[model samples]
Target: MTLTTALALGQTALKLGLICSLTVLALFLSYSMLNVCDLSTDGCFTLGAAVGAAVAICGHPFLSIFAAMLAGACSGFVTAFLQTKLGVESLLAGIIVNTGLYSINIAVMGGSSLLNMNKTTTVFSMMKEALSSTPFAAQTELIIGLIAVICVVAFLVFFLKTRLGLAIRATGNNADMVKSSSINPVFTTIVGLCIANSFTALSGCLLAQSQKSVDINIGQGMVTIALASLLIGGTVMGRGGILKRAVGMVLGAVIFRLVYTIALRFNMPAFMLKLVSSIIVVLAISGPYLKSQWPQIRRRLTHKKGGI
Candidate 1:
Protein backbone atom coordinates (compact mmCIF):
# COMPACT_ATOMS: atom_id res chain seq x y z
CA MET A 1 0.00 0.00 0.00
CA THR A 2 1.03 3.59 -0.56
CA LEU A 3 2.26 5.61 2.43
CA THR A 4 -0.87 7.73 2.54
CA THR A 5 -3.14 4.66 2.39
CA ALA A 6 -1.11 2.96 5.12
CA LEU A 7 -1.44 6.04 7.33
CA ALA A 8 -5.18 6.16 6.77
CA LEU A 9 -5.55 2.51 7.65
CA GLY A 10 -3.42 3.06 10.77
CA GLN A 11 -5.63 5.93 11.85
CA THR A 12 -8.75 3.83 11.28
CA ALA A 13 -7.25 1.07 13.38
CA LEU A 14 -6.44 3.49 16.19
CA LYS A 15 -9.98 4.83 16.26
CA LEU A 16 -11.40 1.34 16.32
CA GLY A 17 -8.98 0.48 19.12
CA LEU A 18 -10.17 3.42 21.19
CA ILE A 19 -13.80 2.42 20.70
CA CYS A 20 -13.17 -1.18 21.76
CA SER A 21 -11.03 -0.23 24.78
CA LEU A 22 -13.67 2.09 26.16
CA THR A 23 -16.31 -0.57 25.67
CA VAL A 24 -14.22 -3.16 27.51
CA LEU A 25 -13.52 -0.74 30.34
CA ALA A 26 -17.24 -0.33 30.80
CA LEU A 27 -17.68 -4.12 30.95
CA PHE A 28 -14.81 -4.59 33.38
CA LEU A 29 -16.31 -2.13 35.85
CA SER A 30 -19.70 -3.79 35.62
CA TYR A 31 -18.31 -7.28 36.16
CA SER A 32 -15.96 -6.21 38.96
CA MET A 33 -18.79 -4.55 40.85
CA LEU A 34 -21.20 -7.46 40.51
CA ASN A 35 -18.55 -10.03 41.49
CA VAL A 36 -20.44 -12.42 39.27
CA CYS A 37 -20.27 -13.34 35.65
CA ASP A 38 -23.63 -11.73 35.10
CA LEU A 39 -25.57 -13.42 32.34
CA SER A 40 -28.20 -10.69 32.79
CA THR A 41 -25.95 -8.39 30.74
CA ASP A 42 -27.28 -10.05 27.59
CA GLY A 43 -30.91 -9.12 28.23
CA CYS A 44 -30.31 -5.94 30.20
CA PHE A 45 -28.40 -4.49 27.25
CA THR A 46 -31.36 -4.95 24.94
CA LEU A 47 -33.69 -3.65 27.60
CA GLY A 48 -31.66 -0.48 27.90
CA ALA A 49 -31.71 0.09 24.16
CA ALA A 50 -35.40 -0.67 23.85
CA VAL A 51 -36.34 1.58 26.72
CA GLY A 52 -34.07 4.35 25.49
CA ALA A 53 -35.46 4.15 21.98
CA ALA A 54 -39.04 4.05 23.19
CA VAL A 55 -38.50 7.03 25.42
CA ALA A 56 -36.75 8.97 22.69
CA ILE A 57 -39.56 8.14 20.30
CA CYS A 58 -41.95 9.66 22.81
CA GLY A 59 -40.04 12.97 22.89
CA HIS A 60 -38.09 12.41 26.12
CA PRO A 61 -34.72 11.31 24.84
CA PHE A 62 -32.67 12.19 27.90
CA LEU A 63 -35.20 10.77 30.30
CA SER A 64 -35.35 7.66 28.19
CA ILE A 65 -31.61 7.11 28.61
CA PHE A 66 -31.91 7.46 32.37
CA ALA A 67 -34.90 5.13 32.32
CA ALA A 68 -32.86 2.55 30.46
CA MET A 69 -30.22 2.70 33.21
CA LEU A 70 -32.90 2.27 35.87
CA ALA A 71 -34.31 -0.70 34.03
CA GLY A 72 -30.90 -2.33 33.93
CA ALA A 73 -30.37 -1.69 37.65
CA CYS A 74 -33.66 -3.44 38.36
CA SER A 75 -32.53 -6.44 36.35
CA GLY A 76 -29.33 -6.64 38.39
CA PHE A 77 -31.32 -6.20 41.60
CA VAL A 78 -33.53 -9.14 40.68
CA THR A 79 -30.54 -11.32 39.92
CA ALA A 80 -28.82 -10.28 43.15
CA PHE A 81 -31.91 -10.96 45.22
CA LEU A 82 -32.39 -14.36 43.64
CA GLN A 83 -28.79 -15.36 44.22
CA THR A 84 -28.41 -13.94 47.70
CA LYS A 85 -31.81 -14.37 49.27
CA LEU A 86 -33.45 -17.20 47.32
CA GLY A 87 -30.16 -19.16 47.23
CA VAL A 88 -30.27 -19.51 43.47
CA GLU A 89 -27.05 -20.21 41.66
CA SER A 90 -25.66 -16.99 40.29
CA LEU A 91 -25.51 -18.28 36.73
CA LEU A 92 -29.00 -19.78 36.86
CA ALA A 93 -30.42 -16.63 38.40
CA GLY A 94 -28.86 -14.54 35.67
CA ILE A 95 -30.32 -16.87 33.04
CA ILE A 96 -33.82 -16.70 34.49
CA VAL A 97 -33.66 -12.93 34.69
CA ASN A 98 -32.28 -12.76 31.18
CA THR A 99 -35.06 -14.93 29.85
CA GLY A 100 -37.69 -12.78 31.51
CA LEU A 101 -36.08 -9.63 30.12
CA TYR A 102 -36.58 -10.85 26.55
CA SER A 103 -40.33 -10.66 26.93
CA ILE A 104 -40.10 -7.47 28.94
CA ASN A 105 -37.98 -5.79 26.27
CA ILE A 106 -40.51 -6.81 23.64
CA ALA A 107 -43.28 -5.41 25.77
CA VAL A 108 -41.35 -2.17 26.14
CA MET A 109 -41.15 -1.99 22.38
CA GLY A 110 -44.88 -2.68 22.11
CA GLY A 111 -44.31 -6.28 20.95
CA SER A 112 -41.94 -5.33 18.18
CA SER A 113 -38.69 -7.21 17.71
CA LEU A 114 -36.89 -4.02 16.89
CA LEU A 115 -37.38 -0.30 17.44
CA ASN A 116 -36.00 2.37 15.13
CA MET A 117 -35.18 5.83 16.31
CA ASN A 118 -34.47 7.47 12.97
CA LYS A 119 -36.71 10.40 13.74
CA THR A 120 -36.44 10.15 17.47
CA THR A 121 -34.24 12.48 19.44
CA THR A 122 -31.39 10.52 21.00
CA VAL A 123 -28.57 11.31 23.41
CA PHE A 124 -26.06 11.49 20.58
CA SER A 125 -28.31 13.70 18.53
CA MET A 126 -28.47 16.21 21.33
CA MET A 127 -24.72 15.91 21.86
CA LYS A 128 -24.03 16.55 18.19
CA GLU A 129 -26.21 19.60 18.19
CA ALA A 130 -24.68 20.84 21.41
CA LEU A 131 -21.03 20.10 20.54
CA SER A 132 -20.54 20.29 16.79
CA SER A 133 -22.41 19.82 13.51
CA THR A 134 -19.72 17.71 11.91
CA PRO A 135 -20.71 14.99 9.51
CA PHE A 136 -18.46 12.45 11.20
CA ALA A 137 -21.18 11.14 13.46
CA ALA A 138 -19.12 8.19 14.64
CA GLN A 139 -16.65 10.67 16.10
CA THR A 140 -19.41 12.07 18.24
CA GLU A 141 -20.25 8.62 19.53
CA LEU A 142 -16.59 7.94 20.30
CA ILE A 143 -16.30 11.10 22.33
CA ILE A 144 -19.42 10.32 24.29
CA GLY A 145 -18.35 6.72 24.90
CA LEU A 146 -14.92 7.83 26.01
CA ILE A 147 -16.36 10.39 28.38
CA ALA A 148 -18.69 7.84 29.87
CA VAL A 149 -15.90 5.30 30.30
CA ILE A 150 -13.62 7.84 31.94
CA CYS A 151 -16.31 8.98 34.32
CA VAL A 152 -17.11 5.42 35.35
CA VAL A 153 -13.44 4.56 35.78
CA ALA A 154 -12.88 7.61 37.95
CA PHE A 155 -15.96 6.92 40.01
CA LEU A 156 -14.98 3.30 40.50
CA VAL A 157 -11.41 4.20 41.43
CA PHE A 158 -12.62 6.64 44.04
CA PHE A 159 -15.34 4.26 45.16
CA LEU A 160 -12.94 1.41 45.92
CA LYS A 161 -11.21 3.71 48.38
CA THR A 162 -14.42 4.37 50.32
CA ARG A 163 -15.68 2.24 53.24
CA LEU A 164 -18.66 0.87 51.35
CA GLY A 165 -16.61 0.05 48.27
CA LEU A 166 -13.99 -1.80 50.28
CA ALA A 167 -16.71 -3.74 52.03
CA ILE A 168 -18.12 -4.81 48.69
CA ARG A 169 -14.70 -5.88 47.45
CA ALA A 170 -14.12 -7.78 50.65
CA THR A 171 -17.45 -9.52 50.24
CA GLY A 172 -16.53 -10.60 46.73
CA ASN A 173 -13.09 -11.76 47.80
CA ASN A 174 -14.38 -13.66 50.83
CA ALA A 175 -18.02 -13.61 51.78
CA ASP A 176 -17.47 -15.43 55.07
CA MET A 177 -14.79 -13.02 56.17
CA VAL A 178 -16.94 -10.03 55.37
CA LYS A 179 -19.97 -11.53 57.12
CA SER A 180 -17.92 -12.48 60.16
CA SER A 181 -16.94 -8.85 60.53
CA SER A 182 -20.60 -8.00 61.26
CA ILE A 183 -21.14 -6.45 57.86
CA ASN A 184 -23.91 -7.68 55.61
CA PRO A 185 -22.39 -9.36 52.60
CA VAL A 186 -25.84 -9.64 51.06
CA PHE A 187 -26.23 -5.89 50.96
CA THR A 188 -22.78 -5.51 49.47
CA THR A 189 -23.61 -8.02 46.75
CA ILE A 190 -26.84 -6.23 45.99
CA VAL A 191 -25.18 -2.83 45.78
CA GLY A 192 -22.34 -4.17 43.63
CA LEU A 193 -24.74 -5.88 41.25
CA CYS A 194 -26.80 -2.74 41.01
CA ILE A 195 -23.76 -0.66 40.11
CA ALA A 196 -22.55 -3.19 37.58
CA ASN A 197 -25.93 -3.49 35.91
CA SER A 198 -26.34 0.26 35.80
CA PHE A 199 -23.11 0.59 33.82
CA THR A 200 -24.16 -2.17 31.45
CA ALA A 201 -27.54 -0.51 30.96
CA LEU A 202 -25.89 2.82 30.25
CA SER A 203 -23.74 1.15 27.62
CA GLY A 204 -26.82 -0.34 26.01
CA CYS A 205 -28.64 2.97 26.01
CA LEU A 206 -25.67 4.74 24.43
CA LEU A 207 -25.28 1.99 21.85
CA ALA A 208 -28.92 2.27 20.82
CA GLN A 209 -28.73 6.04 20.60
CA SER A 210 -25.56 5.77 18.56
CA GLN A 211 -27.12 3.36 16.09
CA LYS A 212 -30.49 5.11 16.15
CA SER A 213 -32.24 1.79 16.73
CA VAL A 214 -32.56 -1.25 18.96
CA ASP A 215 -32.69 -4.89 17.88
CA ILE A 216 -34.05 -7.52 20.21
CA ASN A 217 -30.99 -9.73 19.77
CA ILE A 218 -28.47 -6.92 19.86
CA GLY A 219 -27.26 -8.06 23.25
CA GLN A 220 -27.13 -11.76 22.50
CA GLY A 221 -24.01 -13.38 24.02
CA MET A 222 -23.00 -10.02 25.41
CA VAL A 223 -21.82 -11.53 28.68
CA THR A 224 -19.22 -13.52 26.82
CA ILE A 225 -18.06 -10.44 25.01
CA ALA A 226 -17.78 -8.51 28.22
CA LEU A 227 -15.86 -11.33 29.86
CA ALA A 228 -13.53 -11.51 26.92
CA SER A 229 -12.87 -7.83 27.17
CA LEU A 230 -12.24 -8.02 30.90
CA LEU A 231 -9.90 -10.96 30.59
CA ILE A 232 -7.99 -9.39 27.73
CA GLY A 233 -7.58 -6.16 29.70
CA GLY A 234 -6.48 -7.98 32.80
CA THR A 235 -3.94 -10.06 30.93
CA VAL A 236 -2.42 -7.19 29.05
CA MET A 237 -2.47 -4.70 31.91
CA GLY A 238 -1.23 -7.06 34.64
CA ARG A 239 -2.56 -7.03 38.21
CA GLY A 240 -1.67 -4.27 40.64
CA GLY A 241 -3.93 -1.63 42.14
CA ILE A 242 -7.67 -1.56 41.54
CA LEU A 243 -7.29 1.40 39.20
CA LYS A 244 -4.71 -0.42 37.12
CA ARG A 245 -6.88 -3.46 36.78
CA ALA A 246 -9.88 -1.37 35.77
CA VAL A 247 -7.87 0.51 33.15
CA GLY A 248 -6.44 -2.74 31.86
CA MET A 249 -9.91 -4.16 31.45
CA VAL A 250 -10.88 -1.24 29.29
CA LEU A 251 -7.78 -1.63 27.17
CA GLY A 252 -8.55 -5.32 26.79
CA ALA A 253 -12.02 -4.51 25.47
CA VAL A 254 -10.48 -2.32 22.77
CA ILE A 255 -8.02 -5.04 21.85
CA PHE A 256 -10.81 -7.58 21.51
CA ARG A 257 -12.71 -5.25 19.19
CA LEU A 258 -9.67 -4.68 17.06
CA VAL A 259 -9.06 -8.40 16.71
CA TYR A 260 -12.70 -8.92 15.73
CA THR A 261 -12.58 -6.10 13.23
CA ILE A 262 -9.45 -7.51 11.67
CA ALA A 263 -11.07 -10.91 11.39
CA LEU A 264 -14.07 -9.39 9.66
CA ARG A 265 -11.78 -7.55 7.27
CA PHE A 266 -10.14 -10.83 6.39
CA ASN A 267 -13.51 -12.21 5.28
CA MET A 268 -13.75 -14.51 8.28
CA PRO A 269 -17.14 -16.09 8.78
CA ALA A 270 -19.40 -14.15 11.13
CA PHE A 271 -20.22 -17.37 12.97
CA MET A 272 -16.63 -17.63 14.17
CA LEU A 273 -16.74 -14.31 16.00
CA LYS A 274 -18.03 -15.83 19.20
CA LEU A 275 -15.64 -18.77 18.86
CA VAL A 276 -12.71 -16.41 18.57
CA SER A 277 -14.00 -14.40 21.50
CA SER A 278 -14.19 -17.53 23.62
CA ILE A 279 -10.67 -18.61 22.75
CA ILE A 280 -9.32 -15.18 23.65
CA VAL A 281 -11.10 -15.19 26.97
CA VAL A 282 -9.88 -18.65 27.83
CA LEU A 283 -6.31 -17.70 27.11
CA ALA A 284 -6.62 -14.51 29.09
CA ILE A 285 -8.11 -16.14 32.18
CA SER A 286 -5.38 -18.78 32.16
CA GLY A 287 -2.50 -16.32 31.88
CA PRO A 288 -2.31 -15.41 35.57
CA TYR A 289 -2.38 -19.03 36.70
CA LEU A 290 0.39 -19.95 34.30
CA LYS A 291 2.49 -16.98 35.36
CA SER A 292 2.22 -17.96 38.98
CA GLN A 293 3.75 -21.37 38.17
CA TRP A 294 6.66 -19.93 36.21
CA PRO A 295 8.82 -19.28 39.26
CA GLN A 296 8.57 -22.91 40.42
CA ILE A 297 9.50 -24.15 36.96
CA ARG A 298 12.47 -21.80 36.84
CA ARG A 299 13.71 -23.05 40.20
CA ARG A 300 13.40 -26.67 39.09
CA LEU A 301 15.40 -25.89 35.95
CA THR A 302 18.09 -24.16 37.99
CA HIS A 303 18.47 -27.18 40.31
CA LYS A 304 18.64 -29.52 37.36
CA LYS A 305 21.41 -27.43 35.81
CA GLY A 306 23.40 -27.47 39.05
CA GLY A 307 23.05 -31.25 39.32
CA ILE A 308 24.21 -31.65 35.72
Candidate 2:
Protein backbone atom coordinates (compact mmCIF):
# COMPACT_ATOMS: atom_id res chain seq x y z
CA MET A 1 0.00 0.00 0.00
CA THR A 2 1.10 3.57 -0.59
CA LEU A 3 2.08 5.79 2.35
CA THR A 4 -1.08 7.83 2.01
CA THR A 5 -3.27 4.73 1.96
CA ALA A 6 -1.53 3.39 5.06
CA LEU A 7 -1.89 6.73 6.82
CA ALA A 8 -5.58 6.95 6.02
CA LEU A 9 -6.16 3.43 7.26
CA GLY A 10 -4.21 4.08 10.43
CA GLN A 11 -6.11 7.28 11.12
CA THR A 12 -9.45 5.55 10.64
CA ALA A 13 -8.43 2.77 12.97
CA LEU A 14 -7.16 5.21 15.58
CA LYS A 15 -10.33 7.23 15.55
CA LEU A 16 -12.48 4.13 15.82
CA GLY A 17 -10.26 2.69 18.53
CA LEU A 18 -10.47 5.82 20.63
CA ILE A 19 -14.24 5.95 20.43
CA CYS A 20 -14.77 2.24 21.04
CA SER A 21 -12.28 2.31 23.87
CA LEU A 22 -14.98 3.95 25.92
CA THR A 23 -16.88 0.67 25.87
CA VAL A 24 -13.70 -1.16 26.84
CA LEU A 25 -13.28 1.24 29.73
CA ALA A 26 -16.83 0.52 30.75
CA LEU A 27 -16.08 -3.18 30.71
CA PHE A 28 -12.94 -2.47 32.67
CA LEU A 29 -15.09 -1.03 35.42
CA SER A 30 -18.04 -3.42 35.24
CA TYR A 31 -16.48 -6.77 34.45
CA SER A 32 -12.94 -6.30 35.74
CA MET A 33 -13.51 -4.23 38.82
CA LEU A 34 -17.14 -4.75 39.79
CA ASN A 35 -17.21 -8.45 38.85
CA VAL A 36 -20.49 -7.99 37.00
CA CYS A 37 -20.67 -9.58 33.59
CA ASP A 38 -23.07 -7.07 32.17
CA LEU A 39 -24.38 -8.75 29.06
CA SER A 40 -26.67 -5.78 28.45
CA THR A 41 -23.75 -3.84 27.04
CA ASP A 42 -24.66 -4.46 23.42
CA GLY A 43 -28.19 -3.24 23.81
CA CYS A 44 -27.16 -0.34 25.99
CA PHE A 45 -24.66 0.72 23.37
CA THR A 46 -27.33 0.65 20.67
CA LEU A 47 -29.64 2.48 22.96
CA GLY A 48 -27.07 5.23 23.31
CA ALA A 49 -26.48 5.47 19.62
CA ALA A 50 -30.17 5.62 18.88
CA VAL A 51 -30.86 8.18 21.54
CA GLY A 52 -27.88 10.32 20.60
CA ALA A 53 -28.77 10.21 16.94
CA ALA A 54 -32.39 11.11 17.49
CA VAL A 55 -31.48 14.05 19.71
CA ALA A 56 -28.89 15.34 17.31
CA ILE A 57 -31.31 14.98 14.43
CA CYS A 58 -33.61 17.25 16.39
CA GLY A 59 -30.94 19.96 16.32
CA HIS A 60 -29.63 19.36 19.82
CA PRO A 61 -26.08 18.33 19.26
CA PHE A 62 -24.55 18.71 22.71
CA LEU A 63 -27.71 17.56 24.43
CA SER A 64 -27.43 14.27 22.61
CA ILE A 65 -24.49 13.22 24.71
CA PHE A 66 -26.22 13.67 28.04
CA ALA A 67 -29.45 12.22 26.70
CA ALA A 68 -27.66 9.12 25.59
CA MET A 69 -25.98 8.79 28.96
CA LEU A 70 -29.27 9.21 30.73
CA ALA A 71 -30.83 6.48 28.62
CA GLY A 72 -27.90 4.24 29.53
CA ALA A 73 -28.30 5.08 33.22
CA CYS A 74 -31.90 3.94 32.95
CA SER A 75 -30.85 0.68 31.35
CA GLY A 76 -28.29 0.16 34.12
CA PHE A 77 -30.85 0.94 36.77
CA VAL A 78 -33.19 -1.71 35.43
CA THR A 79 -30.43 -4.28 35.24
CA ALA A 80 -29.33 -3.55 38.77
CA PHE A 81 -32.88 -3.63 40.02
CA LEU A 82 -33.43 -7.03 38.50
CA GLN A 83 -30.27 -8.39 40.05
CA THR A 84 -30.40 -6.77 43.43
CA LYS A 85 -34.07 -6.26 44.18
CA LEU A 86 -35.79 -8.98 42.18
CA GLY A 87 -33.34 -11.72 43.14
CA VAL A 88 -32.18 -12.21 39.58
CA GLU A 89 -28.65 -13.35 38.85
CA SER A 90 -26.41 -10.61 37.53
CA LEU A 91 -25.72 -12.38 34.25
CA LEU A 92 -29.36 -13.28 33.78
CA ALA A 93 -30.36 -9.75 34.62
CA GLY A 94 -28.08 -8.37 31.97
CA ILE A 95 -29.46 -10.80 29.42
CA ILE A 96 -33.01 -9.93 30.26
CA VAL A 97 -32.35 -6.24 29.90
CA ASN A 98 -30.52 -6.75 26.66
CA THR A 99 -33.31 -8.80 25.20
CA GLY A 100 -35.82 -6.15 26.16
CA LEU A 101 -33.77 -3.24 24.85
CA TYR A 102 -34.23 -4.23 21.22
CA SER A 103 -37.80 -3.02 21.06
CA ILE A 104 -36.94 0.04 23.05
CA ASN A 105 -34.15 0.99 20.73
CA ILE A 106 -36.31 0.57 17.67
CA ALA A 107 -39.02 2.59 19.26
CA VAL A 108 -36.57 5.33 20.06
CA MET A 109 -35.58 5.45 16.42
CA GLY A 110 -39.24 6.02 15.49
CA GLY A 111 -39.77 2.38 14.68
CA SER A 112 -36.99 2.47 12.17
CA SER A 113 -33.95 0.24 12.15
CA LEU A 114 -31.70 2.92 10.73
CA LEU A 115 -31.24 6.66 11.02
CA ASN A 116 -29.05 8.70 8.74
CA MET A 117 -27.54 11.95 9.93
CA ASN A 118 -25.34 12.96 7.04
CA LYS A 119 -26.44 16.56 7.45
CA THR A 120 -27.05 16.55 11.21
CA THR A 121 -25.00 18.84 13.41
CA THR A 122 -23.39 16.31 15.67
CA VAL A 123 -20.98 17.27 18.39
CA PHE A 124 -18.16 16.22 16.10
CA SER A 125 -19.44 18.51 13.39
CA MET A 126 -19.76 21.31 15.87
CA MET A 127 -16.18 20.80 16.93
CA LYS A 128 -15.10 20.58 13.31
CA GLU A 129 -16.81 23.85 12.53
CA ALA A 130 -15.20 25.52 15.52
CA LEU A 131 -11.80 24.29 14.42
CA SER A 132 -12.30 25.06 10.71
CA SER A 133 -9.71 27.85 10.60
CA THR A 134 -7.26 26.11 12.91
CA PRO A 135 -4.46 23.70 12.12
CA PHE A 136 -6.44 20.95 13.84
CA ALA A 137 -9.34 21.13 11.41
CA ALA A 138 -8.75 17.75 9.89
CA GLN A 139 -8.00 16.29 13.29
CA THR A 140 -11.31 17.22 14.89
CA GLU A 141 -12.54 13.68 15.38
CA LEU A 142 -9.24 12.52 16.87
CA ILE A 143 -9.09 15.52 19.19
CA ILE A 144 -12.58 14.91 20.56
CA GLY A 145 -11.93 11.21 20.94
CA LEU A 146 -8.66 11.81 22.76
CA ILE A 147 -10.22 14.35 25.07
CA ALA A 148 -13.11 12.01 25.89
CA VAL A 149 -10.81 9.07 26.56
CA ILE A 150 -8.50 11.14 28.71
CA CYS A 151 -11.38 12.58 30.68
CA VAL A 152 -12.88 9.15 31.25
CA VAL A 153 -9.54 7.66 32.29
CA ALA A 154 -8.77 10.53 34.65
CA PHE A 155 -12.23 10.29 36.14
CA LEU A 156 -11.83 6.55 36.67
CA VAL A 157 -8.45 7.00 38.35
CA PHE A 158 -9.73 9.65 40.72
CA PHE A 159 -13.13 8.07 41.24
CA LEU A 160 -11.74 4.68 42.10
CA LYS A 161 -9.78 6.31 44.89
CA THR A 162 -12.76 7.92 46.54
CA ARG A 163 -14.68 6.40 49.45
CA LEU A 164 -17.72 5.39 47.41
CA GLY A 165 -15.54 4.05 44.67
CA LEU A 166 -13.63 2.00 47.22
CA ALA A 167 -16.90 0.67 48.46
CA ILE A 168 -17.84 -0.36 44.95
CA ARG A 169 -14.51 -2.10 44.50
CA ALA A 170 -14.84 -3.80 47.84
CA THR A 171 -18.28 -4.99 46.89
CA GLY A 172 -16.84 -6.48 43.76
CA ASN A 173 -14.13 -8.18 45.77
CA ASN A 174 -16.45 -9.50 48.50
CA ALA A 175 -20.07 -8.66 49.03
CA ASP A 176 -20.23 -10.45 52.37
CA MET A 177 -17.19 -8.61 53.64
CA VAL A 178 -18.65 -5.33 52.56
CA LYS A 179 -21.91 -6.18 54.26
CA SER A 180 -20.10 -6.98 57.50
CA SER A 181 -18.38 -3.65 57.28
CA SER A 182 -21.83 -1.99 57.18
CA ILE A 183 -21.46 -1.01 53.55
CA ASN A 184 -24.46 -1.46 51.31
CA PRO A 185 -23.33 -3.84 48.64
CA VAL A 186 -26.58 -3.44 46.74
CA PHE A 187 -26.16 0.30 46.54
CA THR A 188 -22.60 -0.03 45.41
CA THR A 189 -23.49 -2.52 42.73
CA ILE A 190 -26.22 -0.26 41.44
CA VAL A 191 -23.92 2.71 41.29
CA GLY A 192 -21.16 0.73 39.65
CA LEU A 193 -23.42 -0.68 36.96
CA CYS A 194 -24.97 2.70 36.38
CA ILE A 195 -21.66 4.38 35.83
CA ALA A 196 -20.32 1.58 33.68
CA ASN A 197 -23.38 1.55 31.43
CA SER A 198 -23.15 5.30 31.07
CA PHE A 199 -19.66 4.93 29.68
CA THR A 200 -20.86 2.29 27.27
CA ALA A 201 -23.61 4.62 26.10
CA LEU A 202 -21.13 7.43 25.69
CA SER A 203 -19.05 5.16 23.50
CA GLY A 204 -22.03 4.29 21.31
CA CYS A 205 -23.10 7.89 21.13
CA LEU A 206 -19.68 9.05 20.05
CA LEU A 207 -19.31 6.27 17.51
CA ALA A 208 -22.67 7.00 15.91
CA GLN A 209 -21.89 10.69 15.64
CA SER A 210 -18.49 9.98 14.20
CA GLN A 211 -19.99 7.69 11.60
CA LYS A 212 -22.89 10.05 10.87
CA SER A 213 -25.34 7.23 11.10
CA VAL A 214 -26.99 4.85 13.51
CA ASP A 215 -28.24 1.37 12.84
CA ILE A 216 -30.03 -1.07 15.08
CA ASN A 217 -27.22 -3.53 14.60
CA ILE A 218 -24.53 -0.99 15.25
CA GLY A 219 -23.97 -2.37 18.73
CA GLN A 220 -24.39 -6.04 17.95
CA GLY A 221 -21.61 -8.10 19.51
CA MET A 222 -20.20 -5.01 21.17
CA VAL A 223 -20.02 -6.79 24.49
CA THR A 224 -17.81 -9.41 22.92
CA ILE A 225 -15.45 -6.82 21.51
CA ALA A 226 -15.32 -4.85 24.73
CA LEU A 227 -14.72 -7.97 26.81
CA ALA A 228 -11.93 -9.05 24.53
CA SER A 229 -10.34 -5.65 24.69
CA LEU A 230 -10.69 -5.58 28.46
CA LEU A 231 -9.08 -8.99 28.86
CA ILE A 232 -6.29 -8.02 26.49
CA GLY A 233 -5.66 -4.94 28.56
CA GLY A 234 -5.61 -6.95 31.76
CA THR A 235 -3.15 -9.41 30.29
CA VAL A 236 -0.86 -6.72 29.00
CA MET A 237 -0.99 -4.58 32.10
CA GLY A 238 -1.06 -7.56 34.48
CA ARG A 239 -1.30 -6.09 37.92
CA GLY A 240 -1.17 -2.33 38.11
CA GLY A 241 -2.69 0.82 39.55
CA ILE A 242 -6.00 2.10 38.24
CA LEU A 243 -4.37 4.67 35.98
CA LYS A 244 -1.98 2.16 34.45
CA ARG A 245 -4.73 -0.35 33.92
CA ALA A 246 -6.99 2.25 32.33
CA VAL A 247 -4.24 3.26 29.93
CA GLY A 248 -3.74 -0.42 29.17
CA MET A 249 -7.38 -0.69 28.18
CA VAL A 250 -6.98 2.20 25.75
CA LEU A 251 -3.85 0.63 24.27
CA GLY A 252 -5.53 -2.74 24.00
CA ALA A 253 -8.45 -1.15 22.15
CA VAL A 254 -6.12 0.59 19.69
CA ILE A 255 -4.19 -2.63 19.11
CA PHE A 256 -7.35 -4.61 18.49
CA ARG A 257 -8.66 -2.01 16.03
CA LEU A 258 -5.30 -1.87 14.27
CA VAL A 259 -5.38 -5.63 13.84
CA TYR A 260 -8.93 -5.41 12.55
CA THR A 261 -8.02 -2.69 10.06
CA ILE A 262 -5.12 -4.78 8.77
CA ALA A 263 -7.42 -7.74 8.37
CA LEU A 264 -9.80 -5.65 6.27
CA ARG A 265 -6.90 -4.39 4.18
CA PHE A 266 -6.10 -8.01 3.35
CA ASN A 267 -9.57 -8.26 1.81
CA MET A 268 -10.77 -10.70 4.41
CA PRO A 269 -14.39 -11.59 3.93
CA ALA A 270 -16.74 -9.59 6.13
CA PHE A 271 -18.39 -12.77 7.39
CA MET A 272 -15.06 -13.90 8.90
CA LEU A 273 -14.54 -10.79 10.99
CA LYS A 274 -16.73 -12.17 13.74
CA LEU A 275 -14.56 -15.27 13.84
CA VAL A 276 -11.49 -13.09 14.07
CA SER A 277 -12.93 -11.28 17.06
CA SER A 278 -13.79 -14.59 18.68
CA ILE A 279 -10.27 -15.88 18.14
CA ILE A 280 -8.76 -12.76 19.60
CA VAL A 281 -11.01 -13.11 22.64
CA VAL A 282 -10.07 -16.73 23.15
CA LEU A 283 -6.38 -15.97 22.84
CA ALA A 284 -6.57 -13.02 25.15
CA ILE A 285 -8.44 -15.03 27.74
CA SER A 286 -6.33 -18.20 27.44
CA GLY A 287 -2.90 -16.74 26.86
CA PRO A 288 -1.94 -16.54 30.54
CA TYR A 289 -3.10 -20.03 31.35
CA LEU A 290 -1.17 -21.41 28.39
CA LYS A 291 1.95 -19.61 29.51
CA SER A 292 1.70 -21.04 32.99
CA GLN A 293 1.35 -24.57 31.55
CA TRP A 294 4.23 -24.32 29.12
CA PRO A 295 6.85 -25.37 31.70
CA GLN A 296 4.85 -28.48 32.62
CA ILE A 297 4.40 -29.31 28.96
CA ARG A 298 8.12 -28.93 28.43
CA ARG A 299 8.92 -31.36 31.28
CA ARG A 300 6.52 -33.93 29.84
CA LEU A 301 8.11 -33.59 26.42
CA THR A 302 11.60 -34.04 27.95
CA HIS A 303 10.52 -37.18 29.82
CA LYS A 304 9.16 -38.72 26.61
CA LYS A 305 12.39 -37.81 24.77
CA GLY A 306 14.53 -39.51 27.45
CA GLY A 307 12.39 -42.66 27.34
CA ILE A 308 12.67 -42.79 23.57
Q: Write the per-residue lDDT of candidate 1 for residues 62-112, one digit (tens) a residue.
A: 798689878888988999999999999988998999999999999999999
lDDT of 2 by residue, 1-308 (tens): 99999999899889988999999999888898899999999999999999999999999999999999999989999999999999998899999999999999999999999999999999899999999999999988899999999999999999999999999999999877997998887899899999999999999999999999999999998998887778777777878899999999998888888888988999987667568778888887788789999989999999999942
Supply the global lDDT for candidate 1: 0.77
C-alpha local distance difference test of each model: 0.77, 0.92
TM-score, prediction 1:
0.86
Which lDDT value does model 1 have at 192?
81
Error of 2 at 173 (Å): 1.6
Q: Give per-model TM-scores.
A: 0.86, 0.94
**Residue-pair clashes per candidate:** 3, 0
User: In candidate 2, residue 105 scores what lDDT?
Assistant: 98
